[model samples]
Target: MLARVAAAARVRPPERTGALLSATLVLSVGKGAFLATVMVYLLQIVGLTPLLATAGLTLWGAASAAVAVPTGLLVDRGRGRAVGSVAAVCAALLVPLSARVHTPWALLLVLCVAGGFDSAGNVVRRAMLAGAGGDSVKALAWARTVTNIGFALGALCSVRLLASRSPSAYETAYLLIGGGYLVMAACFATTSLGAGRRGSPSVRAPGVVGARSLRTGGALAAATGILTVHTTLLSTVLPLWVTRHASVPVSVLGWLVMLNSLIAVGGQLAVSRRAATREGALRCFRNSAVWTAGCCLLLGLVRFAPTGWQVVLLVAATIALTGGELLEAAGEWGLSAVLAAADEHGFYQSACVLGETTQGAAGPLLVAGLVTAAPVAGWIVLVAVLGAGRYIAGFTTPPPHKAIAIDS
Candidate 1:
């Protein structure tokens, strides 16, 4: 059954790949459902101040960041499936408890622990997806597409839930998220993943992967940093900038997010195929850099636009940013997958994820203070930062392994 599905989907290793995709879809829904309203839940149901809620979330992020490298190590040691399964179960059991926590410190501690497990689960899942087969890039692209669709649907649901503003609605969202994780765990449990599958190249590949890992990791990390600008802008920076500086209404933020997700869901697979080769990946990254820098500059000029024109400019900027993000995601997945040694993909990818982790941790702080204070100057600085990464990318070489070898 899965074989037929995989054949239709063009994913190899029919059964396992199908399972992974299904699991990814459900997992994404869960994540989107809860995250869309977590802040509201904390502020309204938990009765915490905005500062306290943000602080708790920040601490959770810190914990996730702290454990990422170690989790990668564990995944590489042939524990990817096990770790992900355990994480799913733990999340299922623990996530619902958030509703009962009243104080900030207690919420912080719960989230801190939950964050570590969540981070570990995510890294392991990515490692497993990368190891799916020769067309790991394609498989990941499919995963991303499904994730976006699921997230959009889930976010829509959360939006309706938010309208109610009832504690019961919030609890239901948490429980639904927990149930999603539980289902995802079962999916992982049934798959022949990690070191157990036949012809697992990672089992025969060299174990050390020392200096090679570092070189590849550093390059991918830079690429990740450049890509993160898209996320930081869409999620944190752009909304505030458009609302405060531009002539658009605050409601435009929701439309921008919806537009971004819609474009990704509709175009990710087609865009992903464009980065099938090393050169193609480089080109994608280059275009991403250019578009990102352009968007930043364009956004900087939004404030100077006529009242009616600001919305049009913001939409154009969003299109550029969205295109950059879509391309960057494809390029990142392709380059990182092809660059890492079969034996070292987990560790290498983890290092790459650190770029986003670091950016997520620091980007908000930078945007809140700088971008909020001076949107134009802040965006220009971002443009410079992304522009610098193009040179860094130039210095990066494809993995020493033949492209075919990496794919195999």
Candidate 2:
């Protein structure tokens, strides 16, 4: 019986790809712990005032934003593995060093460095998967599952540690996360996924992506940026819209978030199965846009519905949003892998990250300016824009056959 169960689990991605996914899981676990404990550590252990801590966080964000594109460029130069390893090592070191640092300046400096490494590390992982041939969407779907589980586990573990309410326990948690990073670094160092020599030739000297290809990539990036509004809708827009406008109880928001997370953790694999090929991926992308627009429409409908019906509409909207989120994620992974130039996954993914960055910077303002002020009009405009994306997505062509092969 045990052997049968083990065999059942063996029907998974190739062994070489496990390194990246495992690393992501371990790193995500550490990040989960860090998220729960960092503020307390900064205030209680590092002796930084709340304002200084906020400033340190702000500096870290700035540093991450500044380095996002450059790091992608670095990965495109065939240094994905090296860069990921360095970032992992730095992340591992940052935790222990953070416990030692007390001054705001020192904390800011440490956070800034960590932030850059963090962004670079994400780029490396995504680029590696984009170049890793053979069912990139499915691999990413598995990755998302592992990441969610790891984060949930880490958060639960952190809760136990924090229950002690002792400074030493916090230190121990940081050290534990450092150990996870060490494991992640080792995975990158030993794995063959995009770990070419440190001094390979430039991937972008010339003729890497033609004008047409670059333009297509750019448009995809813009669409991705627009899709980031889904995140904003979940994190910012929904909370405000529901509480202030939707006439629903505040607790429903928490339940909705839980539901979304659950769906992401459980449903991604099933959704990714249909996205194995480029045509299927494009189909999913178009459908995701339709679902996203439907979510917006549902949210808009909440205001017009009766009191009891409002809850139903709101729930429906959440479901639609989650579906769109999962479908979009799978489709994007497939698109990134399918549309990239040969050996240029890093550059292509980096270009896509530009959209994420744009969303991060602009989404909040747009939500405040549009959704908050005129919910119906705002949603209609979003629907129109995303509807247009459905048409644009149909134009994406798959890369050549050889380009889809796994990186050696």
Candidate 3:
């Protein structure tokens, strides 16, 4: 039964292209934890103030937000190897420079370069997976699972490094993350997914429709809005809240994040079976909205956390919010991919990131501003957004029946 269940869990890959794909997830998500905890590290350990940390975050999010699409463009234009290698080297430098520099301007500069390069690399890797299209959805799910695994492991590792080391722990973490990213570049450059490395997505065409056929004007907007709020809370907002509220002793955070990643990985795999169906897509999105909203309200109630047990409960609630991320991301990608035109694969994938990054950029600033004033109120706003997302998800029609594949 265990073997049967395990067999059912993994779909056969189109190609046995192993480490290159795995390394992409490892590099991107491993560094991504810094999106949340690094703020705390910068402020508390590096001696930057709250406002400066916030400013640095805001700058990073703003500087080259559409990098995903351009990264996609680079691949489409056949510059994949060049962009991927350059971005990897940049990733190696982005955070380490932060440790030495305390000036807001210098940090923001490195942060911008880092953000664009990181964003570019994310698309390159996804394009790599998309290049494996006959295995498309399942492949992406595995990619998601691998990325989440990296997320869990990276968060845990960062915490351990911070705990045992002295004040230099933040520097150590950044350097290691940079090295991992540089290694990622090496893996990509040398492996089967390299630009020179050749294979095609079953056909060099989207099986559903061509890019021009995708419902652009209204459908994209509706879908984008629904997905934006879901990811903002999951990736940025909740992480920030935990860092601020439950984070005096940071050792426990890695496990909590790991647990969060584990739930997401499972959710991504479990839902993969029926998740692409139109009904299934709508169902998951709405469910995540309600789940996240309920979790948000729970965030406001932390004042009522009476003891250590309650603190644990609070952490659990936050984990639920993070779990919702898995549901939203899997479904969102499914919908976007199924409805996208053949030529639009690049845009189709970039749409999700662009949507999420737009919200993520705003989410932190919203969080920073609100928390800087009234932390609880900031949380209340997230609940409101979640509720609205759920409502939108429920009311929206499935994609049009014209040349699309909403799965079985």
Candidates sorted by TM-score, best first = 1, 2, 3
For model 3, residues 143-198, the per-residue Cα lDDT tens digits are 77777677666666666655643557667667777887888788767766532132
Off by over 4 Å in 1: 1-15, 195-207, 398-408
Runs of candidate 2 exceeding 4 Å displacement: 1-11, 36-62, 95-109, 158-171, 195-210, 304-307, 388-408
Backbone clashes, candidate 1: 0
Candidate 1 accuracy as TM-score: 0.89
lDDT of 2 by residue, 39-158 (tens): 777776677898887666656656665676666667766677788889888988887677666777887898878777776777777777766666666776787788878877777778
What lDDT score belongs to each candidate, Candidate 1 first?
Answer: 0.75, 0.74, 0.62
Pairs clashing in candidate 3?
A: 206-342, 209-342, 210-341, 210-342, 211-341
Q: Pick the candidate with the highest lDDT.
A: 1
Evaluated at residue 356, the lDDT of candidate 1 is: 70
Give the Å shift of residue 221 in candidate 1.
2.2
